[model samples]
Every structure is written in structure tokens, then in C-alpha cells.
Target: MYKNGLKRIIDFICSLCALIILSPVLIILIVFGTIFMGGNPFFTQPRPGKNEKIFNLVKFRTMDNRKNKNGELLPDEVRLNQYGRFLRNTSLDELPELINILKGDMAVIGPRPQLVRDMVFMTDEQRKRHTVRPGLSGLAQVNGRNVITWEDKLKWDLKYIENITFLGDVSLILQTIGKVFKRADINREGTASDIDFGVYLLGKGEVSREEYNRKQAEAKELLKRR
Candidate 1:
């Protein structure tokens, strides 16, 4: 009952309330991000939602648009300024996603959305993560976030889909709160930060460099249309 209906009601109410309560913080971030990032305050992009449907995912812009001499964007680590790092570390950048939940494009608990381009690389089983609305926090996020491997993250996402319940969602929400407060598993080892899924797959030889580059270009083009 909750999975099919009541959960969405709860999500709508909670997200609405959160947006109201957090309006000040949101306003502050909007102003700060606009000043620091020198552009839009929000980062909006097309991400796959339930059943691979596409929607524009919104979040606070945490990185500056720094480009190199050739006009290519700088590396994430380079573009991510100190304030951006703080927003990421504290999960404050995610606050704007409450609007997504309110709009029915997301849930408070479910599988986190991945890049639309990344969808092409997912195995059939992994694609099951999109069976439900994408979430602000999910099983993979609570368990290991970006620190875990792609395989494990997909497994956790599928597990959540297979076993979603009102109590289960509540438990995951509480656990997510704990994880955020502790700021655990923010990054992987032997690196300055978490690696992108495409990079990870490339390292594992699952995707050729050419394919990854092509997919990246396609993603950029798609985002441009948005």
C-alpha cells in the first residue's frame, strides 16, 4: 500500500514541508552560489526517472564553470571550490531536490538517479533500478555512497526495489540522516574524490575509451538541449 500510493503522499507532504522550512537556507545558497559560481544558482540536468523516463534533476550548483585554454571544462577537483566542497560534504547541495520530490519526479527514499548516458552502459539487471522514482537518498547512498563499486551500488539499488516498504523507507531515511551527519564514505581511497561511473567502467575494461568518449559527447549534447 505504501509503496504504490501512501509513500508518494508522504513524500509530497514531507518535501513540501522541507521546502518551506529550508527556504532560508535555500535562499542563502542561491545567493552565495550565484556570487561564487558566477552563473545560475541551480544545476539542472536531464536524469532518468522511473522506467527510464527523463526529467530535469535540480540541485544547488556546487562547482564553478572553470574552463581551460582550449575551452574544455576543468577537472571536477579543480572546478570544485572550497565552498562547493563544503556543500558536497554536508549534503547541503542536495537540498533543492526537495522540489523534485514535490514535483513527483523523485521520492524521499528509492534508488538514486544516474546520468542519462550511463543508462546505455547498464546491464539489464542493473537497469531495474529505474523501476521506481529516483530518490534524494537511497540504499546505495546510505550504505557506501560513492565509495562503493558500481556493481555493489546497483545490487543495493535492486535490493531496495525488491523490498520497499513503509518501515523500510523509514529505516533508510533515518540511516541516511546518520550517514550525512557523520559525513562517512564521502570519497574512495587512493584518490582525491569519488570517481565517475563511466571512469570506473573504463578502468574495469567494460567500456572502450572511444565508447566512453562518445557517450560523454552524447550526454553533453543532451544536456545542451535541456
Candidate 2:
């Protein structure tokens, strides 16, 4: 109980301090993004927070609105400009989420908020991640991040939920700092976007019948390797 209390206090104080130090940087990003992206500097999307509650999570816009020859929006690669890629590599794009923390919509550390569509694949056990407010950094993120499989990320989330403590949160924060400095696991090679849970599931045949048999075979092989 004391640890939980301390964690919240740490979240409050740390987030407040960060907001002060990052304010100038945030302002510059907004102006630059507006000029380059031709819209608001920030991107807002509904994400699943604690208890599966939805909240408008914010991030600095790291891609432009560019479409393909068919008039459909282009792939993430096509939309990702050079400046956007740099911002992502430096993790400056996530700065706007500090506002979410200040608004009581998130914490500085916990399971990173996931998309609503991703929630559909979560089992009851996996849903335990929602017991605490989603955060900007989490165990999975500090670990392998984009390199880890969804199943591994789920395990780390559960571990974090069970072992949450002030010290643990601090440790995760420190680890996140190292990751940012090293630009580790920021994106998959040959891709400008992080792997989407929905797309991964569809590709793996988890949501479709035609590919179900093939995916099931692959899953069995994966299990055997494990």
C-alpha cells in the first residue's frame, strides 16, 4: 500500500517536472509539425486505458497525410517524412503524452496504452493490464519493445502489474532513458511504423478462416520451439 502511494506521488512529481523542462521543445515541435504536416502538431487517437476505458491519447505528429495513386492513403512508409523519422528515433514524438499524464488520463509508468482494436484479442488474463492506468513506458517497452512478440509483451505486462512498486517504476524509467539514447527497438527494419497488433493478428490468421490452418501450423511450431 505504501509503495502504491509512493508510485503515484512519484508519477505526479516526475511528470510535472518533465512538463516544465520539455515545454520549450514541445512548442518548437508544434510549429515545425504544423508547417511540414499541414495540420495540428499533435495526433489524438482513442486508446484503451485502465479498465478498458477509452481516452484520447496524444502524440506529436510523426507522419504526413499522403495518399497513393488510387487516392487511398499511402502506406506508413510513404507518409513518413525524413524529419518525422528523426523525431520518432529520438522519441520526441511521444512528448505530448505528458499532457495525458497531467490530465489524470495516464501515469508516467505502467503498461503502454494499446489500441481499442487490440483489446478484442486480449484474453481475460491478459486484460489484467487494464487494472492500472496505461503509461508512457512499461516493462515490455524497457525490455525488447518492438522486437518482442505480442505474447511476450503480454507476459511482461502481467509481471509489471503484479510487481508494481516505486522502485520498479524508477527502474523502468531509467531503462527507458537508456533505450531512447541508444535509439533501441524504435522500429522494425525496413519499416517506419511499429508493428500493429491488428495487422499482426490478421497476418497470422488469428482473425480469418482462410489462413487459419496455416497459422495454426505455424503457432504449433512456435510452441514446439518454446
Candidate 3:
């Protein structure tokens, strides 16, 4: 009952309330983010949602667009300034995702949506993470977030999918709030972006380097055709 219907209802109500209640904070972040990041305050990117459907995921922009001499964007560490770090640590950067949840592109608790390009690299079991709506926070996030390996995160994601319940969702939500208050696992050592799941699979020999390169090439080709 909850999974098919009530869960979405609760998600809609909660997200709407959150947006209303957090409007001031959102406004402050938008103004500051625009001033510091020097672009739109919100970041929007295509992410794979339930059933591998793509949606534009939104979040507060927390990094500046710093380009190198050749005009390629600089690395995450170089672009993430002090103000950006504060937003990330406080998880204020995720505030805009409430809008996503309200729009039915995300849930309050479920597997986190992954980059659309990463979908081609996932194993059958890993692909199961998209069987449900993606989340703003999830079992994997509350468990270890960027601190855990991608395999471990996928395990948690699958576990959550298998055992999703109204009570379970509430529990995960509470745990997420606690973790955010403690500012736990905001980033992995030495970088703002965690280890890429595709790169990790290649490093562990789960996928050959040639396969990785081919998948990336295919994705790029598809993007050009689009």
C-alpha cells in the first residue's frame, strides 16, 4: 500500500512542507551561491530514476566554474571554495532536491539517483537500485555515504529496496537527520567528489579497462547524436 501509493503521498506532503519551511534558508543559499559560484544557484543534471528513467536532478550549486587554459573545467577540489565547502558540510547544498521530490522525480528515502552515463556500467544486481524512485537520502547514505566502497553502497541500496516499508522509511529519515546534524561523511579524503563507481569497478578488475573505455566512448557518442 505504502510503496505504490501512500509513500508518494507522504513524499509530496513532506517535500512541500519542507520547501515552505525552508524558504528563507533556500533564498539565502541561492543569493550566496550565485555570488560565490558565479552561475545559476541550482545545479541540474540528468540522473537515472526509477526504472532507469532519466530526470533532471536539482541541487544547490556548491562549486565555482573554474576552467583551465584549454577551457576544460578544473577538478572538483580546485573549484570547491570555502563557502562551497560549508554548504556541502552542512548539506545545505541538497536543499533544492525537495523540489525534485515534490515533482515526483525522487523520494524522501530510497536509493540515490546515479549519473545517467553510469547506468551502462552497472551489473544486473546493481541495476536493481533503480527499481524504486531515487532519494534525497537513503540507507546507503545513512550507512557510510562516501566512506564506504561502491559495492557496499549497492548492497545497502538493494537491501533497502527489498525491505522498503513506511516504518523503514521513517527510520532512515530520522537516521539521516542525525547524520546531517553531526555532519558525518560529508566527503572522502582529499576530494569533494567521491571515487567514481565505474573507476572503482575497473580498479578491482570487475571490469576490464577496455570495457570501461568502450562504455565511456559509447556514452559520448550517444550524447553527440542527441
lDDT string for model 1 (1-226, tens) is 8889999999999999999998998999999999989979899978989988789899988789999999999988798898888988899989999999999999999999898777767789999899999999999998899888888989999999998899999999999999999998877866545667788899999889999999788777766675
Better of 1 and 3 by TM-score: 3
lDDT of 3: 0.88
lDDT of 3 by residue, 115-176 (tens): 75677787898999999999999999999998887888888999999978999999999999
Across 75-140, the per-residue lDDT of candidate 2 in tens digits comes to 888888888988999999999898888787799988989866566566789989999989899999
Flag regions of model 1 displaced more than 4 Å: 190-193, 209-226
Models ranked on lDDT: 1, 3, 2
Q: Which rank order by TM-score, best down to worst?
A: 3, 1, 2
Q: Global lDDT for candidate 1?
A: 0.89
Q: Is candidate 2 or candidate 3 better by TM-score?
A: 3
Deviation in angstroms for 205 in model 2?
3.2
Give each model a TM-score. 0.91, 0.87, 0.95
